[model samples]
Target: MSDRQTPLLGPDVFARRQERLRQELITRKLDLFIAAPSTNFQYFAGYNPGRSERLIAVFVPAKGGSVIVCPSFEVERLTRNAAVQDIRGWEEQEDPWRLVRTALGEMKPQHGRAELALEHTFDYASYLRLAGVGGDWHIQTAQPVSERLRIIKYPEEIALIRQAIAITEASIAATFAALQVGMTEREVAGRLSEEMRSRGAPGGGLVQFGPSSALPHGGPGGPKLAREMVVLIDAGSPVEGYASDITRTIWWGDAPSEEFKRVFNTVHDAQTAAMQFGKPFTTRCQEMDRTARKVIADAGYGLFFTHRLGHGMGMDGHEVPYLVEGNETRLEPGMVFTVEPGIYQIGKFGVRIEDDCLMTETGLEVLSHRVAKL
Candidate 1:
């Protein structure tokens, strides 16, 4: 069982979030920001009413308070949990889009400035209805506004992430200790999942053994674990809506081959170099990617080092402020992300070392220290 404590978010937190979103709307020149049934909606509404063919939305107007429009059956659940006072519901036969239109019209948005921003997860069919009802109001993606607020970690969120990481590490350690040679990749993955769930994790993640590790996202049913073969386990779990992601590659039974040792060391060094370069307010997000990529490229494994160096982590396993090429977003204090550099050789083996890190005033702080040594 995990000894780490999970932090709780109260109504005040949601209130502050709504206020911040309202401020962002004004600053970004958006008239109405709409979040459907997704993380963005949960971030403000304090609950996820789930997604469906029916329309469920939260409208945050720039000049006034927010409102939630859901099916009549869900109104009571939302009312109990959501911070927003305005709750509008529609019955089975009624058109929910009309309710959304009524809510938007009530906002009294000026025609020329009636710009609507919808979350990326908003369904396309609903978008059509909302767009038609919105008349001449401009429609755009709300990712910028919502991602801006979610990329930075609050203290409570960090606490949950820490607990998730601890639980994930403990489960991985247990799984590794119980692993036996000749076990199938699926068997090992099942054991890992059971261990993680037992340790209070919501679920487990990827597990690849032997040559299957060569595929970055290798499917199950690959070769069995054997002596001197590489084993890669990339797993995580949720702690109170927050998430933890980590990847560790290890040799199975006996000592690894010289080539395996060299590749592992190179990948490890790349991850270290990237983390060291991730300073707040100074380093661009892509710099971390470049730093790690350069290390692998210099080691003559450039082509093998496919995919981005890492990605941001939070309520969702992967989010904004991605550590990849062409992302110019500057790192800031309270920003958290992963630093994972890997090399994949088809029909051979792969090595990946991933860890979570938080950007602080002084520098970057690594959050997961369980599998630092290969």
Candidate 2:
């Protein structure tokens, strides 16, 4: 169907990832890291069984091998692709929390006063169960440790993300070419979805038009496309487990008003400024946001730019190293993220341009570049 190549990550990559995570755990002074069924677990284990009422987790001890705990029926399925060898299965009637505790006890015999970091996705009930397992253990969020590891991309990971971006760009181009003045927002979104899926994307994302485009993260079912309306399409595709997120806004027909051109140019200039400012070892994450915000603010459209400048993009569309106020994480080589600056005027129109960028040893490398012109 699709001409794109799907690269496979070998066992060596998984081994290295585990080693890095274990090292990070030690550095963070955490004894054990527990991950529920989430992107973090999939990142390590290479298997993504959807989350459910039943408990499924990967337990990584600071000193030793990782283990997965899941339902009995899923043991075989999980083992087929998961890199971790030790998988403990719980019967439907058994309490999985006890099994998890047993596994942790085996991994660390001196469990008393142990420090454990739980992935953020764990449900409250699961958290309480695991918290009750050992009375003296310290429990905290695993975000710091996990986010640190996932924020940096491996070469193979970047390749997958690139493939996804390529597919997404093609899909958006097709949607734009096929769009008509009378087409509904839903119809345009459907066309975008068709193009993406036809190109082997797992799914399609958002497409908004006209006044609805003024709302960030707007849904479909809005008014039909009209002449001189702003069209905004924010969509992405997943390649392997990595993701590609991009957004582009355009005027449907004829030249837009001078005000619209000014806003567009301001947003474009803001994105350019952010990209120019993003450099490895030098640019703090929030600095990118500030640089972009300054451009819009100076142009007198500061209040219209409603959201943060950007966010980290990888396995999850939005992740660590967020480009927003209060985040002081410095950019580093191998880190990938989005630099999207927008101007949304409620009841009127919106304009946003996003590009996925990789922080390289030299500087920022823009990954999604097909739709650069506004």
Q: Could you tell me every candidate's TM-score relative to the true structure?
A: 0.95, 0.95
Tens-digit lDDT track for model 2 on 327-371? 899999999999999999999888989999999999999998835
TM-score, candidate 1, is: 0.95
In model 2, how large is the Cα lDDT of residue 333? 97
> Candidate 2: which pairs clash?
none
User: Against the hidden true structure, what lDDT does model 2 obtain?
Assistant: 0.86
Each model's lDDT: 0.86, 0.86
Candidate 2 structure, TM-score to reference? 0.95
